[model samples]
Target chain A: MIEIIDLTKQYGKFTALDCLNLTIDKGTVFGFVGQNGAGKSTTFSILATLLSPSSGTAYINGFNIRSEPKAVRSQIGYMPDFFGVYDQLKTVEYLDFYGASYGISQSERNKLIPQLLELVNLTDKQDSYVDILSRGMKQRLCLARSLIHDPEVLILDEPASGLDPRARVEMREILKELKNMGKTILISSHILPELAEMCDTIGIIDQGRLVAQGSVSEIQQRLKGEKLIVVKLQHGLDEAVRFFEDQPMVSGLVKREDGHSLQFIYSGDAEDQVQLLKMALLQNLAIVSFSEIETNLEDVFMEITKGVELT
Target chain B: MRNLLLNPVLNKEFKLRFRSFKSFLGLGLYLLALSVLMVGFIFLESQGSPMGRFRPEQSRTMFILMSFIQMGLILFITPGLTAGVISGEREKQTLNILLTTNQSSASIIFGKLISSVSFLLLMIFASMPIYSIVFLYGGISPGQVLVVLGYYIFTILVFGSIGIFFSTLVRKTIIAMITTYGVTLFLTAGTAFLFAVSMSVSQMGNSSNNPFALFFVMLNPVMILFSFLEPDAFSELSNQLGLGSEFPLWAANMVTYVLIMVLLIFISVKKLRPNMKVKSRR
Candidate 1:
């Protein structure tokens, strides 16, 4: 439900967002992956109507960000990377205040507050002062505040940053639940694996430009050339090594630190792999285990951003 | 107008301000200072009089003294209350989220100015019993007391708008506070000094009416209060300046201040909008 068309933002001579174009469909969780100062926050701020793009424009739910900012704001919820809570406000009061800011009625906020607190697992702490909450809890409260208006889209800038591992998992689960509830989320995080697991589509941004955008598997397939395979033999390790060495598909082979295993880079299809296994069995090598090493999101990201410099 | 006044920013500000211990402490300190001044004035009046019988004219002077003190307190407290309204939000990193909401920049500015003015009004109202002390000896009427309170309200509007204007212009709260105080001091004291200098210059020259001198002093709230307490003096000055007008001096002063306050608030609202400068550049 979000579309950014040739969006460029320049602060004097330094460009913050450089001719970047992206789109996220309705009810999809789009993970924005980038390192520090990679224009993720700038893009989010532009979409949220908190910053004007130097050139081009964006739209959310069919409303232009620059021209119809109020409508855009009404359709989107934005949570900044760092924010402060009012000292004397309670959790419910904090949400109530934002609800009113979005022009949500009192009755609707009263009904929505408890549901939001429960969604963020902060229902028990709803009566506590916002300043007294832990950082992770405060982050969750911020998420709830963003949802107070029940916007169709959520623009979260590093929602899981600075959280403990467990809190990160909780946040991940909450985002997953939000996805199930059909909210289109554009979440930016440097953590690659989490985004891989949570996102339907992932876009990598570098130096204000989107370097890569696709599904995780699609990116992996695009970057994958030679697949790494490991073979573990109970006895007949020499026979397995010789078999792999003789195979034309096996380009390079190395013995594992364990005395009984052989690892090799194989450029082969599934049929070739099956034939190699059949040949191993025919050679009477006691194969314990054989598996292909999967390429992860981190590897894909590193391969894509290898020579990139900070802008 | 109703929607503009009853905004989320105002609602939250009122709640946070009144609920904090600082509000109570500020009120207590304010009353204590006023009480000390009232008692000191009573002591001086008793000592100056023959039989401990304070005259009604002395009570009138005391009323005027208390009004000026209240005005001074307003001048001092209002800037401190409003100088951080926008810059504080920026420091807290909440302005982005606030701007992303449905609340307009005008609403936020109005809400902030009104809330700060409302707190100052509360302090002024709480000090009403101090006015009763002056009322025990009858010289100042209730209407006069109300007029003084109305002037205090006008002063709050002017000073509070100045604070908000500076707050939006500057990104740092400390700098905003300092600039607000500097501007306020210039308006209250420096303007009167310039008026005095202009009057002396006019006296030395051809003795013609100096509209600059009259306008400068009229901009000063202290001079406005003097004109309110003594209309004949303002009229005589106006007649001497060959600017005899249908409107009273206080009315003219209020109009001028109201215009200035509106300008400050308009600038503040514009500045508080995110990327407004960037948008304007396009």
Candidate 2:
């Protein structure tokens, strides 16, 4: 459980995070999506209790990040964006060090570490030196380190970044297992579709502001008016474009470079779309196929951040 | 306090440091240097004497030289050991994750300082058997050796704290090391230079006593060690600087170093935070 309330962070005149607010309930996975210089990492840093906000505060599992940072730290495990492994230490030793830092007893750590290594699919590499491991293994080791204390919440910043496709899938599978274990996870990723599959909800932040927040479909539904329609024509592509431009719901039309298809923003509902397609057929525009493009999380993110529909 | 001493950072540091061949190599090289100093000193003494006949008083000179060399080694090695403690963590990007754990900032700083100093101590202790050569000469008492050991500890802590302070203040390890060496040089040599200049100025100005010279001389660790090792020469210098008979210069020097070490440790703990503003419960 995490609650961020009106958190503002200012570095002189530049506002890294501006009066932002967010909340993630227990057992839910929240994905933070933002471009570089956006406030996602800044927000995660604040919630991780590493940086103090200039104004306002956050709470993790009912512990105030500002007033009760130690409690907050105890409740949540944090994995930063970069891999921070000590090259000289073996994987198990590395995990043990973090476990000890969290005050986990030797017996408990001995038990927990094997379970953690299994969770991250790093059991065999337990005895291997961290430096010798591949990037993916090191990342997984970092993940295991975060989970060493069995914290109720996880704050993972770009955990899947820089991994190869297979490693990324492995990471995703581990996250899915974590989701099943009922851990409240806060993750951020540049890979939108992977995040869409892993997160229960995604929050889009733009230029230090949370522009959109909801499930992927919920965000797409909110931007329903901006749905794009692709029309394939056997002939009279120019004529169809002119006809579609005259229609009340059609705007932002662009001809396909292939010269056979065109797309336009369609604001009408399903029935209205059918009626418009019927009119195009009646005009003898030689329409071969007409379909609406399903907006994915990437589209929603772009639409929100580009000062388009969500703004 | 026990938890602080056995903190995970210290344990990890010990493992990381000792597991490497470099530590043992460094210790071996250190002892070799000390052995060479002894052999060279013995050769020069025997060369001057008839058919290697030795004077017992020369052992005292040898002890003093060996002690000064050990002190120099401590001063030279302490900054290199400690100046990278925190900054290296930062470079490796592990400091943030370490901070996010339940370990307090003070524990991290203290653990690092102790770990580095412990390795230096191990080297110093390992050299004790080598010091048996001096012991066999019968000029230096065991009490004097213990006092020298205690002085080495104080000097190590003082210089190590200075290194850690800079390590916390700066981000780059090389920069921290440079600054640490700079401060150490100033404390050791610059203070002595300032004392010389102050005494010269006092002599030319017809002033019998200069507080500046006294202050500078008292702050110099080398001068303090000399006060204990070569008291007659130190007294002449002390008298020239108008030092009173009320307090031993070495004790006053240790107190001054203790105060400085405390202040540096305090500042280091505060500055160790990645962000200066680490807010806790109101």
Candidate 3:
């Protein structure tokens, strides 16, 4: 659980966060969506008790981050966007060092090291020097180091950046497992579609301002009026396209396949639109699947943050 | 638990500072040079005065003086060791991870300070055999050696803390190191010059002792170190048998120096308190 109230940060005349207010429930994957220099990392850094807010109070699991920072720190784990491993230390030794930093006992640390190594799938590489590991492996090890104290919440600032596809998938799965284990996570990533599939709630930050924050569908619903439908047909898509062109609600259609599927960008919601499908059915278009694909977070991001282009 | 929490920093410094072949090579050559020079000094100066000739009485004085000289070099290196504690971590991008942990800023700063100085202390301690050789000349007492060693310890801690403070405040290792060296230089050499000038100026009129200038001597570790090293050389030049009022009784200077070291450490810690801000969560 986390609560940030009126969180504002500034550097002289430049503001990093603008009276930001946000709450994340336990076990909820809260995606902090923001472009570069969007104050997302600033907000994360403050929550982790690494940066003092200019004016704000952050609470983690009911512990005030400014006052009871140690208590708050004990309850939260932070994985920075970029991290370094102790160059000379082994993977397990590195984890144990952080475990010791969190006040975990040596005996307990010795026991936890193996489990953590296994969790990150670096068991065989426990004795390997951390600097020699690949970027993704290092990232995974950084995540495990944050978990050495078993903190209740994880604030991961762009954990997937620079990771290869397989590594990103593994990182995602690891985070999903952490979420399934009832740990609340605040994740920031450049990959919007991946976040769209994983996050229950999302907050978009642009130029130190929170322009939108809510569920996926709720955000999509808030998009300026228009709807898009993706149709996947088994066969005879040419016939289906000609039949759907007559529909007044369909403002635009892009043929995506030779004789299969295409998307219809409709200007109106036009409920009880089954009449169009019925008309297509009469044409023997052999339509297999047809559904509305509303605007995604990526579309909304482009819409809102494309700033001057949108203007 | 506190020690465990501190060990990583100490461990990193220990492994890196000790495991390197160059460090060991430096230590070996340093010891060899000191031993050869010490033996040569004792052998050649066993008979007449040390200036044009040598006296057994002044032989111990020379050793004590050399001990302080070695401590001066120790003082010089202490800042180099501690100056990188924070800034080097920042350069490597390791400071943020440590800062984000449950540990308080005080602990982080203290741990770093201790780790940085730990190796210097080890190097100084390794030179103890050379210091112990002074006892064989029968002029200096074991207590004097201990008081001198105590002075050196405080000297290193103060210099080391100054370095750590500058390291925390500066973002570059070279800048932090240069700043630390500059501060130590000012404290060690600058304070001595001020005291010498004040002592001379005060003695010109009424032969009155300047408690204020004497007070600065209390604050300067190197000056206390100089007091412990240098015997009453002026009196010795006049062929006095024993006792000169020039060196503020060694025990007193030693105690005063230790107290100053403690106070400076506290100042460093206090200065760090307001700046080490905690991170914010989103």
Candidate 4:
């Protein structure tokens, strides 16, 4: 569990985190969505007790990050965005070193390391040098190192940033496993779709402020008046396209590659959608299926931060 | 104390340092350099002597020469050993993770310092047989040898702390090493140079006791080492500085070095966590 209250961090005139407030419940997977330099790392660093906030404070599992940093440190595992591994150490040795650093006894470390390695799907490579492993494998090793103390919360900042698609999927699967194990996870990334499939709730941060926070569909619902409708047609694609094009609500009509389906962005509510559907039926445009498509978080993010500069 | 003894950083550093071929290569090169110098000095001494062989009384000079050479090696090697401990971690981006762990700043700093100093100690201990060569001639007393060895340990501690202080202060390892060497040079050579210049300058005037000159002499590690190795060698400097017989220069040197080392360690620990504000909750 994590609760941040009015946490602000400033560097002279530049604000890295500006009076931001957020909370994540126990065993909840909260994804922090933001572009690069959008204060995601700053917020996470504060929660991890690595950076001191300018004004307010945060709490992890009832321990204040500023006051009880050691308790907060013991309760959470932090995997930084740009961490470097001890290349000279073996995978097991690396994990062991961190375990020892966390004050775990040697016997406990010996028992916990193999299980952590297996959890991250790095059992076979435990004996290999850390530098010799692939990027994905090293990421998994770092994940295991973070889990060495078995902390209740995990603050993973961009865990899958540089991974290839397959490795990203691997990381996702491991996170799913962690989710099932009932660990509260706070992960951050600039890519929306990456966290869309895995996160239970996502918060969009921009320019040191949190703009949106909710489930994927909840956020999409909050930004109403713009809905995407897909119409599957038996025929008459040109006529249906023209009909929707004539309507004031419809814009950005996209024809599907499959000859049967075409989608269009409609800027109207449910009542208007129903009226539009009635008009399409009256036109007898040979409609097979007509339904509103759920907008993904990526589109929701774009719509929310519309005029904001990226990078 | 127990925690410091079994520090995980110490364990990891030892494992990494010894496993690499570089450690062995460094040790081998170090011994080879000392051996070549010792052999050359002995050969030249034998050629200059009337009997065409080294004499017993000459072994004391040889021991003194070897001790100075060993101190020079320590002065050269300690900076390279300690000046990268923290800055290298920063460069590799591992400092944050280490800081987030349960280890306190004191643990991390002391762990790094002890580990690096232990390596330097290992090299010094490994060269013990080289010193044993002087023992065969029976000129140097075992007590004198112990005193010199103790002084060498003190020298390593002072210089190693200097390296770590700079390493923690600077963000880049290369710059940290350069600053460490710069400070070390100022301590070893600059102090002696200033002492000589001040002594010469004072001779033109009252030529009495100058506390500045006395302070320079006490701060100079080379002078302290010589005082330990050959106490009479300090007589001229001691007489000119009006130093009392009650407090020995070597004792004053110990207090000064200990004070400096403690100050450096204190600053290093404080600087290690510049942003960690620990406020106790009511």
Using DockQ as the measure, which candidate wins?
Answer: 2
lDDT values for all models: 0.87, 0.87, 0.76, 0.87
Runs off by more than 4 Å, candidate 4? A227-295, A307-311, B278-282
Among the numbered candidates, top TM-score falls to 2
lDDT of 1 by residue, B1-282 (tens): 789656999999999989988889988998898889888888898898899877888888888888787788888889899999999999998888898899989999999889878888998999999778988888888888888888888789888999999999999999999999998899888898898888888888867778888788778898788777767787787787656587666777888888988999888887776652255232
DockQ (Cα-based) per candidate? 0.35, 0.39, 0.24, 0.33
**In CAPRI terms, where does candidate 4 land?**
acceptable
DockQ score for candidate 3: 0.24
Residues A235-309 of candidate 2 have per-residue lDDT tens digits of: 999999899999997877899899999998887888898899889989999988998888776776766786553
| Docking quality level of the chain pair in candidate 3 | acceptable
For residues A41-98, what per-residue lDDT tens digits would candidate 3 score against the true structure?
9999888877788887888999987887778778988999877777678788788878
Worst 10 residues of 1 chain A by lDDT: A302-311
Residue-by-residue lDDT tens digits, candidate 4, B1-282: 888877998899888888999889988998888788778878988899988977767887888888887888888889998999999999999998998899988889989998898878988888878887787777888888888888889889988989999999999999999999988889889998998888888887886878788888888888888887777767766887888888988889899899999999989988886454742121
Question: For every candidate, how close is chain A to the native chain A in TM-score?
Answer: 0.78, 0.83, 0.77, 0.79
Clashing pairs in 2: none
Which residue segments of model 3 deviate by more than 4 Å?
Answer: A224-297, A307-311, B1-8, B43-55, B203-207, B211-216, B231-264, B267-282
TM-score computed on alpha carbons, candidate 3: 0.80
Two-way lDDT contest, 1 vs 3, winner? 1
Give per-residue CA lDDT, model 1, range A42-125, as digits (tens).
Answer: 999889887888888888999988778788889998999999988899999999999999999999988999999999999999
Give Cα distance to truth, residue B56, candidate 2, Å.
2.5
CA error at residue A95 for candidate 3, angstroms: 0.8
Model 3 agreement with the true structure over B1-282: per-residue lDDT tens digits: 655445666666666567678888988887888888887887667644446544547657666667767787877789888898888888888888887676666667667777777766777788888877766656778887787777677777767777877787788999999988888877778887887787677667554446656655655766556665554552342122123356544455557655755665666555443332543333
